[model samples]
Target: MKKDSKSLYYKDYLKLDELLSSQSPRSKELGKEAHDETLFIIVHQVYELWFKLFLHELDFILKLFREKEVDESNIGRGVESLNRILEIQQLSIRQIRLLETMTALNFLEFRDLLFPASGFQSVQFRMIENKLGLDENMRLKYGSSSYKMPLAKPDASEVTKTEKEPSLFKLVEAWLERTPFLEFKNFFFWDQYSEAVNNMLAEDKRHISENPNLSADEKTFHLKEYASTEANFEAILNEDAHHVLVREGHRRLSHKATQAALLIFLYRDHPILHLPFKFLSKLIDLDESLTAWRQQHALLAQRMIGTKIGTGGTTGNVYLSKAAETHKVFTDFANLSTYLIPRSALPDLPENIVKNLGFYYSPESDES
Candidate 1:
């Protein structure tokens, strides 16, 4: 079949025309004298775009979890989305290092033009902090989300400054709340069953169940306390009471599966003992690659401008070091410490590896 003449591509759906022409040079001198100014503009703009996509994908995962869709297929897909977000984050960090290639002199060429401008003012970044479970109320404490834009439209600049983006932490919290623990699921199931039993006992809803408030704890407690008041009536409701008592005996069993599931991710060796083990191992390699990127950024910053405060008024190399600490090579090995050879319990070895030849367990006496 022939394609429709009105068919629109992804770019068409987006307001690309507005975005494409959004960058403005400080001056003809800044644009012409500083050859890399355009590079600076595009790098930050591209980073913002990546952040936007990350927020979108993460929001999708949140909605899926909210709808009680936690089968293997959904979880697999959610993890895939998370992997993509992590990849994009790694790319943004690379772009930050790329800022080092150009001289601060080039940045200084237009530095006076920036006035109070700094990447520290990025609100999208603040939103990311909130998403990651950082205190949202503290954005201004660090100077992010409070800086005003000097050159953009009032509304656009205001939106950029004020809007708090959704984060992964919020998504996970929502997931845990709506997700039924086995205990809750069984309670809900039995509540329905108890209603049916009550109906059976009362031919026309006259004879309510022994515990009319089976679904509610306070009401159940009240009825139990008043049981002696209605001791004679209890005989009439003995069958229904007996049935509920029988179900309560197996209540723990019903909740056991869900409780066990809660333990698997962190308790039973989990992804540490599963396929994510391989992904984490590979990620360790990627960690080295990423650390190389950070080191490269520091070196590049030195090459461009040594020991100088960042244009955004940050202590350049020192600030980057703090950012570098946030990057973990992998997390699977992290949780394993609590379950296995905990880091706190591990004895510190002697400085020389050759001096401590018998550090590891002997194979013959290692296990039961």
Candidate 2:
């Protein structure tokens, strides 16, 4: 049995005195002391705290992926971290409901006092975005200036540092590219998968053309849409096409990584790939949760201010809506569903490959 050398109190341990005193509503400072301003400040402060925790979990995941060879156990741990992150993101989205509780008129009571200081100025949020692999080039400008324009010198500098670092997206792509099962001896997963895709597309086209209920124009329209889907599948099947899409900013994942990710998705039932599949799924969930939060925030802003500009001088909800549409990071993983064949159509793996992908007991080894 052991006790701490120095006794600790809950308030002291958590610095509750400092944390509780940090919420200084601008309305109060300006002598109006709006009742809802305190809630407004607390909501944003809580968001920043969650953003900090996000960075902590991301840093751990990033470290694991940075290694030359990430152990399966580490991938499991990374999946656990991502699960926690997804939970936090869901909570963040829910918190917007609390903000919505304040009426537009109530928000305006203290909103004017928050001039030139919008949620756009949150440095930690920017860091989180950077760490998650949001491309700098893809960011929307803040009223003709860079998004970093509103941050203080030190905060901007920290964000710049994070931008240069390898993001979770980059690390995961590298890890996927390094996946060994994509090509095992005579079994080339993509070769088989590509054939399956072509067969599936042909079947779809046949079904569309043979539909007895469809008119000529309806068949034409459906055929045109099917052609576009075929082209999308071709982009992944052809390395040069995939690269062209990457150069055009239509895709973020590299060709090999995309293929490996596809393999993981198609064969997620394999024991060895279960963790990787879960990890990738969580990443998609994380991206989706953030998008959901952004969408909710945009709605909240529009509800609070109508078409008015944000206190930070931006176009408010318009800017947030655009960012939500474009800020996604793991969409490629989600879009892999486009290429997935039914289990009935999936290519059977060689016995040896299946053995490698599953855990098996060996009585002889145990006897030794």
Candidate 3:
């Protein structure tokens, strides 16, 4: 048992007095206070607090991936951090529902007091986005200017600095590229996987051509659709084609990294791969949760203002909607499902490789 030298009071420990006193709404300062203004200020302040927590968790996860060889236990811990982030993101979306409790008419009571101070000015949120590897070039312009144009010089500079750092996406990609099982002696994962995919595609084509239920026109249409899907598989199988997609901004993950992720998804049952698979899945979950939050925020703004400009001089919900559509980080991981084959269709690994992938123990025999 351990005892503190000094007794700690809850109020003093949390600085509750300072926290409770920080919510002075602009409407209140203007001599005529609006009731909803207090709620507005509190909600935004709470959002900033959650943003801070996101950065804290992200910093830990980033550190794990930055190592030359991340341990399996560290990956498990990273997955746990991602799970916390996803839970907080869900709460953030629910918090929007709470904000919606104030009607549009009520919001108007104090909305005018918040001029030129947009959510775009949230430096911490921007840092979170950058740390997660949201490509700055892909960001939608904020009212004919860069997203950082709305921020104060110091905040903008801080965001600019964060963009230069290696994000979780980059580090994870590097880690995946270093994965060992992609090639094991005489067994090459890509060769086996590609052959299986071709067999599946050939079966699909035969089915489409021979189906009695489909008319000639329907068969033609289906074959065209099948060809498109087959081309997608081809792009991944061909390194040059994959590189072309990367050059054109259609894909973000490098070819080796993409293959490694697919290997993880396809062979997730392997004991050694289970944690890596979970880690990758959690990244996709985090991206999805953020996208949901952004979409929910956009809807809330649309409901509150109805096509009006934002107090920060942006185009209100339109910009928000566009950002929601494009600001995704781990979509490549999610899209790996496109190439997944059934466990039954997967190639069998060599005995040596299987032993490496598994956790097994056998007592040795001794002869006298």
Candidate 4:
């Protein structure tokens, strides 16, 4: 055991004096304090603290991805980091429930004092979005102004710099592009997978055509819908077509990255691939959690002040709801399930590749 030269006090260590004194509600400042104002201030302060923790974890994950080759242990660490973020996001959603307990009238007691200082001005939240690679062009604009328009100049500059840096989405896509199991000597996976997909679609068409219960019009409609799904899978099989979708902003993951991701998903049961698969799954989970929090916040705002303009001057619930629906960073990865086939329908990997994708641990090998 090691002992420091000077003993540290608990209050001094966490700076409790500074922290406990930071929450001076505006209603208190106005000489008539409201009961709910303390809760409002504390809730927001807790969120900012959690946001700081998110950035700390994100910095480590980004460092791992920036390396030329990430180790397997590092991938596990990255998954752990994402898992922490997921937990934090769940807390964020739950905090809304706590805020709602203040009631609409309770909120109104101090809400006017918060004029021109809404969640839109939260620089930390904007930083989280930018670092996760929310596309700038796709953002829900407020009266033709940038989302950053509400930020102070210094904070706005930080957001701008973050945008120029490589985001988590781009880094993950690049890492997936460098994945090894997608191709093997004399055994390309995509070609075989494409053939399987065609056969599956053909079987579906046959089933639809032979169904006696379906009217001719219903059958025709189902066939058309089936065709659309087949064409989408076809786009994945064709690199040039995938590129066209990327150009149109309908997709963000590169063709190589998308293929590698699909391969991992299709063969996730392999011992070596399981961790990477979990990492990808965590990304989708993180995105979904954040979206849930955003929607919860929007609904809370609507409940507090029906359709009114935000304290920050934007259309309150409308802006938040639109952002909740559209502001996703891992949408492309989630949509990859559209290309997934059942385990039975998956194309079997070559034997050598299966070995490569497995973590063999025989006694002889371990001794060696």
- The TM-scores of all predictions, comma-separated, are 0.50, 0.91, 0.93, 0.92
Winner of 1 and 2 under TM-score:
2
Task: Point out where model 4 deviates above 4 Å.
Answer: 1-5, 210-221, 357-368
What lDDT would each prediction earn against the true structure? 0.48, 0.87, 0.88, 0.86
lDDT of 1 by residue, 27-139 (tens): 55455545677777888899788878876775666555555434445555666766776688678667776777677677766656765676555666544444443433322
lDDT, candidate 2, at 15? 100
Q: Tens-digit lDDT track for model 2 on 237-286?
A: 99999999999998999999998898888888888778888999999999
Task: Report clash pairs, candidate 2.
Answer: none
The root-mean-square deviation over C-alpha atoms between each candidate and the true structure, in angstroms, is: 21.0, 4.0, 4.1, 3.9
What lDDT does candidate 1 reach at residue 129?
44
Best by TM-score: 3
- Model 2 lDDT-worst window of ten: 359-368
Model number with the top lDDT: 3
Q: Estimate the TM-score for candidate 3.
A: 0.93
C-alpha lDDT of candidate 2 relative to the true structure: 0.87
Ranking by TM-score: 3, 4, 2, 1
lDDT of 3 by residue, 6-102 (tens): 8787777899999999998888788989999888889999999999999999999999888876878789899989988998899899999999999
Compared with the true structure, model 4 gives a TM-score of 0.92
Give the clashing residue pairs of candidate 1, or none.
131-167
Worst 10 residues of 4 by lDDT: 359-368
